[model samples]
Target: MTASAEYLIALAGNPNCGKTTLFNAITGARQHVGNYPGITVEKKEGVHLFNGLKLRLVDLPGTYSLTAYSMEELVARDFLALERPQLVINIVDASNLERNLYLTIQILELGIPVVLALNMVDAAASRGIEIDAEELSRRLQIPVIPTVARSGTGKLELLEKTAEVAAENRSWKPLHISYGADIDPVLDQMETDIAGSDFLLDFYPARWIALKYLEADEQVINKGAEVNPELSSRLEALADHVAEHLQKTLETYPEAIIADHRYGFISAVLKAGVVHNSQRSDRLYLSDQLDQVLTNRFFGPLIMLVILYAVYKATFDYSALPVEWLNAGFTTLSAWMQTIIPPGLLQSLIVSGIIDGVGGVLSFIPLILFMFFAIAFLEDTGYLARVAYMLDRVFRTFGLHGSSVMAYIVSGGIAGGCAVPGVMATRTLRSPRERLATLLTAPFMNCGAKLPVFAMLIAAFFPARHAQMMFLLTIFSWIAALSMARIIRWTILRGPSTPFLLELPPYRMPTLKGLLIHTWERTWQYIRKAGTIILALSILFWALMTFPLLPDARKSQFEADRQQILSQLPEDTRTSLMQPGIAQDGLTREIAKASQRIRAIDRAESEATLQHSYAGRIGMALETLTQWSGFEWRTNVALLAGFAAKELIISTLGTAYSLGGADLDAGMSLSRRLASDPQWNRLRAFSLIVFIMLYAPCLATVTCIAKESGAVKWALFSLAFNTTAAYLISAAIYQGGLWMGIGG
Candidate 1:
């Protein structure tokens, strides 16, 4: 069907009213998801074809009321009014008809065509309640269709009814809620003023905006003021005058009373057409029992921890073999390329730069896939909402809404995937303070891109037994985040916690297609970033370590010095130093004497080369400040480069060790290398690991923090606080270890 001629159906409902389920059932996998124009709120559109007709369905955000206290509500209201959809498919939960119908009544008053899709019919039936759809439709002067959306029952009928209503341009009769007489006159005048505007008349019925303005909805007031200043001022004055007449404050207007009127009307209709049996169903009792345990105060935190550990284990442990295979394949490919290509800059660029950089990212694919699958399973089983409900009380203590917990959990998997969505999730939060606090701290959670760095570090330092250490460190990062969140909430973000009101939906098996899509999307993001930013940085790091030809100069000087010393040692000794094989000469004896002197100079030259390089200079500068924490210049340089991205720590160490060509099996891991160095003992290694764990987040994380928080101040604070903490902890580890005789 052509776009203009296609039927448009908009899904509108209150929060937790089964609207999302209905949308999912109707659209299935044939949907495009994005954000609303100029806002972060999700927008989902899908095309469904049934009975030779095409329908373009739009799913609006769940909103309690259209008064615009939050962006979600405002977006829902604005889209309905401005878009002027052909029909609004109002999905109201039958079990909670009173609260849900309030939104339905408001939509009816907008004078737009609406078809009531009485969703969750099964739930209502299980509650021993029955509603006569025909009788209810007759009373409301609109069509009402019963639906169990999850089971796809009545979906076809709902669509047919929607098409019929939209095609005929059916008008829904206005239902009036009786606000007290004291406010009626002001509403009437405000309505008249609103009617004068062509823009208001084209979308929303004049009466709706009038009621909203009388209620002092900032969104309506701002829009009205922008459109017509005079009208807005008059409306404000009318609201004030009405408040004076009623002897009440303007902002504390009778919203609850008006709400009660709508509920009263709903009750009257229900009494006429709805019936309820005496007994409650088994399903309801079972669901309630499960909710109690899952959301219980004492067991909730423990449950959350267990679930998180399971996710980590499944993602890291189960996928270890596949990740290893990928790493081995890349190594084999790099080795093969070395033989086929001439040994030059191009070979180095392709093998060490491109292969290493891209392979490093791809190696984490197993973990990324598993993480997404685990999240999908939790979401599908409805455990995610339960998790939110359970954590509400605890999260509130830190000025974070329970809903913020979801963002943190998702971000913890991959920090850079989409901070927009992570921040957007905070809309479920009721308090502005909690939302802002969550937005600030969300980026600190390690994302998928950081996984490789962790893997590399753990593998290098604790190779034989690293998985458990990696898991423990992962848990430690979260603990640190929670502690920091508490500090911020109490010291900087002092405020009352928002009320936790969440709905726990029934569990269902997740769709494999959806799971795969989500997993691939996140995995692709990690791969792309590594290929671009990480790859470029790796090449630049290689250059910094290799350039200016100091090693070559040292080798040339050593050869010349050895030749001169050997020449004086006699013909046999000179022949031995010049020959390729040690066995061919008394040559071997002469060469051994010369090797000792050359070794000392080579060590000195290696130190000088490092001190003269760009990275070395920066390291030395940082060393002056960080020496107390047992950080040498090389460690300082590694830490500095690590800020670009934590995964670079591995590459930095590899470069420092000059082992890019060394076999993984043969080369000493970073930990072992450090352990062997007399200057760096066990205490230093432990201190360094602790410092890495608590250091300032990588550059990508900092960017996400700034974007999500909507300011540079919070991002800078995260960096400053984390870096300071790392330094202090590292210093303590060093000094404490010495004091305790763990290290000298």
Candidate 2:
């Protein structure tokens, strides 16, 4: 393409157009997902090798048009205009050609080399519709390849055509379409002034900029004003004059006329023997027939609930044994480390700080894996979109836009997502108040970080009803988020509800390869976070719970008690009992009795030392207030660490218990130890789950909320409001449960 070995190609299309499926097919596992610079919009890049040439493919955010109405559109437009990828594979739905072509027309107007991917040809064929790709391509003067991305049909041909286009090394030639006599004169004058002055020409073509102004695109108008106020003012006046004249004459805005013309052009092209429909007009397609029942007002919500419960039940049932296996493996590893390392700071650091702490979080990978698999399955099947559609009715009642459903889902409304992306996803909302309300309440959803904590507590306290507990938690999170959104909307961020339009994609069976790739991508993110952030925080919290050792007098008292017990025993028995793992082996009755007593002393000494440490003291200080919610000093420390990252709750608790000598025998899981703790019970565990689900989001999420909302005050409000509400509600539940003698 450019005499270099690597060519950059951008894959872009409307959402639900199989763009991602095609990208995955091309790149397989060679992909990286990250945020665009200075924005949280996800940037996906992958390498595809063809004909001994490495082509780098960037999967741009899915958007309906190049107009900057949402963040996705902005990112896609900026990448194309600024980065100028060598070629673009514009994926359009073959079954919905007219609607999808709107974006294609906009892309072509940008003057970049484009190859139209008429994706979902099989779906179109299933509906008795046929597309003449050569006819369409000839009309548009570009390659049009029919593809079924889900099954890799026509994939090779699409890539080859894209490579040929890139090799052409063509200069950009902006497409021109007439918008009738009313606006064409003004548009031409604006374009001439724009080009003669080279105004904002570095990033956009002259005619394209003129069209943007006539459309009243906010981002373009603002940029034009910044670049040259006087010229921008003249152009704006011309655009306004044309807009007013068109509005008065035709009762339509410039953008409306522009869209009508674009559609007009597409219609003319298709009418020229480009598309053929064999089905009767009255016949309903398969997707519409399915939607009749799946999106029914009465049956849709019920079916969604049933489906969600099934997902939870399957995940828990399938993951339980693997979770136990991981727990056993970590416990064995911890014990092995203890046996190899002598009893000292080194042993404690490895056994308690690193092993016990990180292992607690790691043991839940099976659950995370299964849950992610379920989410990916639902997403790939397009059922999640229906969930959002059904929930929109309920969301509207709670002052949330239907678009908010996606934000919540991405935040784990279904229960395996994250708040950062959920917060970032709010960029799609047009209403400022609705967006703010959504982002503020989004963290209440059970994100992946909170998943380990919930899984551990449920296993320890509600073992018999894993799926039911998770389902109820999902229900509770939705209730909490919606109720809070209503309150916030009616109070500080007051606003009337705006309309929401959602496009439901046709359901396609997910390929095992795609599902596994998605599952691993999400699960690996969870595991990676555990290994990095959670590991570091675990070590830090461990040090806080381990340092400032007991005073010399207190240490001497415990040492004296140990020696006293040892002195009374026979020298051989004392020596044998002192060695690790020997006390559990053959021993006389008297020696066994003495060993138990000494072990009790060690537990007491360790407890005393923990109480004297920094984290313990902090927890103790908060106990007076938090005890009302059934949390003790140890639980308080764990909750404190949860603010940094929710996964740390399990790890911090593990470290705290390991340091406090909570009867951690080799191969005993953290849940078992927690279950056996005197201070923990069903009521307390449920209360803790409630608090963790509703409390302040992790620091990363708070930072994201701030960045997305463009204000630190809202972030602070999220933290303060969430924590306060969580404390009050959890305290009420705990106190009420105790009054009723329920699991007290």
Candidate 3:
């Protein structure tokens, strides 16, 4: 349906309120995940058909209040005031009636029509608490529906009520409440001034705008100041007067007074039989009971490790079969093209450039998809919050807030996440220094883009212990991130640290349907990038690796060698060797050996040609410096491509090996090629993995870092510092291992 024709409904609530579950149920496979404009906050929209009309639901970022203390609050505020949805579905947790209603009241103040979904009714009943939905709805003058959003109970009625409310022909004005004797007169005067000037009144209700101004909302105050400096000055003067009066009277700010009055309104409503509780106030729920042990000081960290290791094992081990299948499929397709097309630059470009280059990255699709599913499961079950809670003490020792842990986890501390979002997650940190340290170090986590490279290397060198190796790598990434953060905090970015604070949401079993939605959203993102950006960069890097063919003299030498090998064999035996499979005599074996030798020589010539090409020259130039890290010119090439995007490390290696080492006709996986290559072995592979994990982030993440930190120098510093750090550490490991007689 056309967007204009569809009814726009917004779903908003506090974090962990079953809002997402309700959205998943109502939308059901019709959702799209996107970022809000100019920010990293995710915008999730879904559509549902209702009574011959279409309902478009946009899931706003979860926030506790409408006060502009965070980017989420601002984004939600803008979407409501500007887009002006017909109705908002405020999904309140029935179990946490008062706490959830805090957000509901914020939404109500926005003046939008709201249908309250008192979700988790069963959980509330189990706690011996009940909410009178009708009475609450009457008191709030909005439709209220009690729903067990998880079980699909009361979902239809909620949507039906929402549609009824949304279709009504009436204008919404912001909710107004008295803020007591001290501030009421000031608020009334500000409202009069706002309405008289018609300042921001078209978008926001006059009193609401006045309220935000009184709360010192920077966005609102700035906009007002911009619209009318004189009027804004007068309003601020009045707000300052009230702030001084309130501080003298009750020792608080205007915002605090406003909040107190809001709660007072809610308390009065609840006192009028709107809620009933028959159980003990401190009764332990299942989540609380689980938390007692799960979030223990000692065992919590251990259990987190065990859970993370299991996720790694599940992703790598279960994904092996599909990974192999995808590798084989791409190989087969490349082979088919080789047979059909005449051999030359066109055939080589199609096979080596497009197929092998892109296919190598795509081959890990199963692992990426599976990893996303495991992460989604952890997040959906609310264990991720507990993880951060448990890690708070660990982070504080290093001068980070508990909030920093979420950024690390989101960036792939557990594996299969993105650094961009991780950097954005630093917004939760109130301390600039801690946030900057996190922004600088978050890329060290093993993001999904780097997962394929690590997975491929592990498969090639550590095949027998695939899962264990991955688990170790994950731990190593965390160690590097935390260590780098500690070093950075203590030195360059050192400043006062913030106290630790965290909210551990109650644990719930992840719904299978919700897991699928989240998994598909992330997997589709990988597939999309593979089709577009990765595909383009693959072709570009292919040309860079393929050109500057061996000189005519060099070609003549190889041609002469090929002729000598052919001349040594009988014509029939040589001809038989040319065909792939045939009976072999003593003579045929000699001929086959001669043919294989000639093929190897030609491959060497191609390798030499790549060494002389533009990309090769750059890699070769860096070889002397990187040699200490055990990176040869070819590995140097992969590392260079990695800076553009980590996925390119795998693709570039695939192309590099495909060009000169393995004949496309052989159809071996890249891991097999690397395993067979004499230049690569266990020590060098480990070194490369270490370097890739700790080196500079992809260009996109660097851009985000620069934007978020508001300094290009920080991005540049990260590039230089991380590269230097990764090189030294890798060199140490490689040199140390060599000295210990670990390599052949």
Per-model TM-score, in order, reads 0.78, 0.97, 0.97
True-structure Cα RMSD, model 2: 1.8
Q: Using alpha carbons, what is the TM-score of model 3?
A: 0.97
Location of the lowest summed lDDT over 10 successive residues in candidate 1: 659-668
Give the per-residue lDDT digits (tens) of candidate 2, residues 153-252: 9999998888788777678877789888887888899989999999999999999999999999898999999999999999889989988988889898
- Clash count per candidate: 4, 0, 0
lDDT of each: 0.69, 0.90, 0.86
Q: How many clashing residue pairs are found in candidate 3? A: 0
lDDT at 718, model 3: 88
Best by lDDT: 2
Q: Tell me which of candidates 1 and 3 scores higher on TM-score.
A: 3
Pairs with backbone N, CA or C atoms under 3 Å apart (clashes), candidate 2: none
lDDT of 1 by residue, 1-744 (tens): 344567778999976566777887777778776778867567889988766567899999888777676677889888878887888999988877777887888887777688999987887776676878888888887899999876778998998898777778665445566676666676776777677655356656777777776677787778778888887888788876765655564344545546666677777777854646557455455557777777678887687777777676666777778877787787677667766877566765666556654565666677667776777667656787787777667677666777787877666622223334565566566666677677656655665545565665555455555546655665665666677778778888778776666667655455565556556545665666667777788778766755554567665876687666756676655554443223423435545766445444545555666566777778888987798788888778778878887667655654554322222212233434454556866577667776876778777667666765678997798788889877987898888888899753
